[model samples]
Target: MTEPVDEGLVIYWRPLCGFCQRLLEALEVAGIQATLRNIWDDPEAATFVRSVNDGAETVPTVVVDGIVYTNPPPDQLVIHLQQA
Candidate 1:
């Protein structure tokens, strides 16, 4: 029997957020595959994002499995995901 592998990280952000754009660009440069969820398009996602950060609608919030990162920088996020 094989253990189930995690499906990588999920990033919740908005298209117009500069920080989100930076994070995306960095992820692209690092060749990382992250599930990008735009909160603006999905109300549930927006609500979820807010829930993760005490009702703060901060973009570039990423969830690695259940671990939440509220607006973490690109490099920091890279290291964090790698360790996960």
Candidate 2:
């Protein structure tokens, strides 16, 4: 995972999650670097995810340019990352 960048790409996820794994893999394949935050390990990240997802600790909660995108499609996320 890449280091966190100011107002850049950030993904809040967790282990044993198929959606998270697939999304991360797709981003890597698409050459889109991002900061990964594991909700299990980071309390603040977990809270943030819950806040965005209506109290669910949803994996693959992505943040780009300060805008939250919950469970975004892989291809769309890649395009958004490239554009940002």
lDDT of the candidates, in the order given:
0.79, 0.84
Tell me the TM-score of each prediction against the true structure: 0.84, 0.87
lDDT tens digits, residues 32-74, model 1?
A: 8988778889887888877777888898877777667788979
lDDT of 2 by residue, 1-84 (tens): 223335588989999999999899999998888888899999888888887788998889998887788898988888877776
Residue 61 CA error for candidate 2 (Å)? 0.2
Whole-model lDDT for model 1 versus the true structure? 0.79
Best by lDDT: 2
Worst 10 residues of 1 by lDDT: 1-10
lDDT of 2 at 1: 28
Report how far residue 72 has shifted in candidate 1, in Å.
0.6
Displacement of the residue 83 alpha carbon in candidate 2, Å: 2.7
What's each prediction's clash count? 0, 0
